[model samples]
Target chain A: MNLLRTAREMLEGTSYTLGIAGRTALALPQLWRRRRETTEQCYAASVKLIHVIVLVGAFAGMILSLQTGLALADFGQEGSIGSIVAAAMVREMGPFITAVILAAAVGSALAAELGTMKVSDEITALEVMSIDPVPFLVLPRVVALTIACPLLAIVANVVGIYGGSIVAESLLRVDPLAYRETVYDVLARPAELFPFPKDIYAGLFKATVYGFLIAVIGCSHGLRASNGALGVGEAARTAVRNSIILVLVMNFILTRVMYT
Target chain B: MSTAASDAGAAVRFESVEKQLGGKQILRGLSFEVPRGTSFVIMGPSGSGKSVTLKHIVGILAPDAGRVLVFGREPGQLSRSELASLRSRIGLLFQDGALINWMNLEDNVALPLREVQRLPEREVRPRVAEALERVHLADAAQKMPSEISGGMRKRAALARAIVSRPELLLYDEPDAGLDPATGGSINRLIRRVQRELGATGVIVTHSRSCALTVGDRIGIFEQGRMASEGTAEEMATSSDPRVRIYLGIDGEATTERSDSRGAEHGTGATGR
Candidate 1:
């Protein structure tokens, strides 16, 4: 009987602008704090993630050069290889690759740590102490990831450009100087290189939002998780799955809006 | 004794509280008073709403139909800073210890003092060391929560809770998972801390020993209200069958005892 009434109250709560405003008011500080904490955790989590990005970038650059070199060679347009690879990497590949890396690396960790805390009642302990877990746990990671994602995007660009250069010089037998000039010419336009920063910044913004979303969802779900190891596992899986989907959806929406 | 007077000027009150969740009335028109220096035990059967009662004291759950006061101000009436100030005076010992796995024992214990108190870095170490010593876990300060035993984790939690020298200590089933001997020791710690620090203690526990040892007064919760209230001796000798059953002692006459505690929530034995 009381549950029905409580549900009704919650429903009525959804009907009011004041209720929505109050909910937002209460949630904003928590969201801000969550962003800050997630940023901190993201720093530690991103170290290994950066290593993976480097390894993948190096190999990915090598593979792109090989395929593009072969294709251009067949068309007797081998010298156009550096420009083609540079356009693809700077325009799209760099940010896309970094986003995917963070979703797997830092996203998973946020889920697992928050899940463990939730199952173990650490989050409850915070509530009892009147500490906002959002600031203490979530915000650091958000801030850290926000900063780290852009830095990683920059790193991917450097490695990818170098990979394209290597393919142009070695696989196509083009001179290193010629390949460098072609790459520069292709990237010389402000539209090409200018968009890089926007893309990188947007990628970082997405990552920050992504980190915050994952941490909040993870912590919220975990804190509400049923008691047991299974609950923790479920929370982690859910956080990762949800974050990946959100990241992709956000990336699609944001890229179109920014570029268009 | 000195700080006790200061906190009396800052006591928390709850008036005619009622709370319902999911069609179930967890707390129904419950009212209570907690003064500055007395340890108050909230005793009840599994679903009698003891845990919900504690949540109200901390402002985690706003009462659906009544008022809850901390430092003479309603939790909702106070500004965020004022509420935080009130909260800083109260220390909570969670049932599962709730130690942060990413933090070492020392850092976990030192967290509030650093974040809320904002003590200098040099000053934090000694305060952390002293707090850990109070719980007899000074040497284990560098260990992770997983590295410690369940009992040690509880001790770490105690260290963290008391590190800031809070004026009020709240325990949610402080003795839930321990053996009888260990639970007794925990009870003694509760009493010892309350006595030494002169802090008001509110403990929710089914453990009779814990209540007897630590609480100066006991309040029995039943059917979502304060069913009965008395001293431990009065309760033990009362004619109330519910009180007798709560004491875990069988009585000699025709006493009506409801077995509702075991019916739902599995005795809430270890507490959520």
Candidate 2:
């Protein structure tokens, strides 16, 4: 009986998430009509998240480069650490870490904010005033996330690559110029399977998808929130948890699809 | 009976409306009407579905059966765009004020005018200022909702509700959770705003004082049904034991207890 109930809840949650995504898609035109609102949301989501993205990206890059360099040293291939770090960050880790940061920061904030509004009847008030909550609230957030995620991913890419280079030069005794040259060469090379370099388009695709998913999931939890303050807190926690899990799961899937 | 009178220029009418929420029947064949350009107050005990009834008028909660007519049109039958257009003509002041906490008082009041009505900033500014002034929150215009007193927040919400000068206004527990003086002032504000806009007004409240002060007509809800409805004088003079018990007019405490239970169980009408 417990298992059945859990299964039912999961199904309901998935449908609810899909419903929000569909509504957000339909409300996309409001991004133009309410450009100022969308712009403000975009600025808010991006500005607060940039620092986290850079800090996390740099550390992740350094750790990956140092560990991989040490492992490859046994094989006398430590000089190729730049190629591995650049490829991993660009194709996977950059977007994944950026998404995780955004999920914790922006996605949780969105859920808490909207959940408070829901419990307080502000969303109902909007509807009473003839403002569809989807167009007025969710559309701007979704559009902003979609726009901000890719830009943050780019920032992550730059920071991560630079961090990897610094670690390679300092720890692996690899030449800075040689590491830079190898990273550029590896990222610019065409894939044997795909038309474009695996890193560029694939990383961006993941970032955009992660951004869209975060917004939709956060908004869904928020809109369904009830009970009041405790409920709002729960919604925020759930949004962040779900966002992190989904981002990691999608990262693995996307990497496999793009690379293998 | 209310539905019959509804056609005589009623702004809102509910004919045998039923609603169930969270496995409980909240509005059980409920019926009421608010005549155009008049104030109708529905007073009830806690959990008696006053707010749910208010939601039905705006199409926020559709009736499970029967009809809810707003501006002589069935809200459930309208398309989304059509419903939005319909709602633009109505204003709602929710319980707890429902002001956007992130926005300052002035912007909160200006939102409906700018977003819903699509009014330009030049036009929105003056209207927002005037509404704030009327609510006597002009000094707190730049203050966020959390920065203000509860009474001030309620006033700010009132300002937002009236800023658009809607054709209809709905207030859900407008006087709830306030001291008598603050609740009295909010009630007076509701009356004044309704009169100024000539908007049909429907207020949900538990305060008999609020109902008597603001209602051109009053309905008493009990157990998901409107038990009695009349003008202030008529309701005050009502011989119905449930009405007397609710109004605190019955001197006998034992009778009050029995009547209260009956009202809760929806058996009071038969007992009377």
Q: Best-fitting candidate, measured by TM-score?
A: 2
At residue B121, give the lDDT of candidate 2: 88
Give the clashing pairs for model 2: none
Mind giving the per-residue lDDT tens digits that candidate 1 earns over B20-138?
97799998888888777887888888999888877777777778898876656666556677667778988999998888888899999998877788789899999999988877777
What tens digits encode model 2's per-residue C-alpha lDDT throughout A13-41?
88998998998898876678878878898
For model 2, what is the error of residue A107's alpha carbon versus the real structure, in angstroms, after optimal superposition? Answer: 1.1
Each prediction's TM-score versus the true structure: 0.79, 0.89
How much is the lDDT of residue A113 in candidate 2? 91
Overlapping backbone residue pairs in candidate 1 total 23
Chain B: TM-scores of all predictions: 0.86, 0.86
Best of the candidates, DockQ: 2
Candidate 1 structure quality by residue, lDDT tens digits, A85-196:
6766665666667766776676666667776887777887776666666556655654566567667766777798797777677767877787777777777654444554
The runs of at least 3 residues in candidate 2 whose Cα sits more than 4 Å from the true structure, single-residue gaps closed, are A191-197, B1-8, B249-272
Worst 10 residues of 2 chain B by lDDT: B263-272
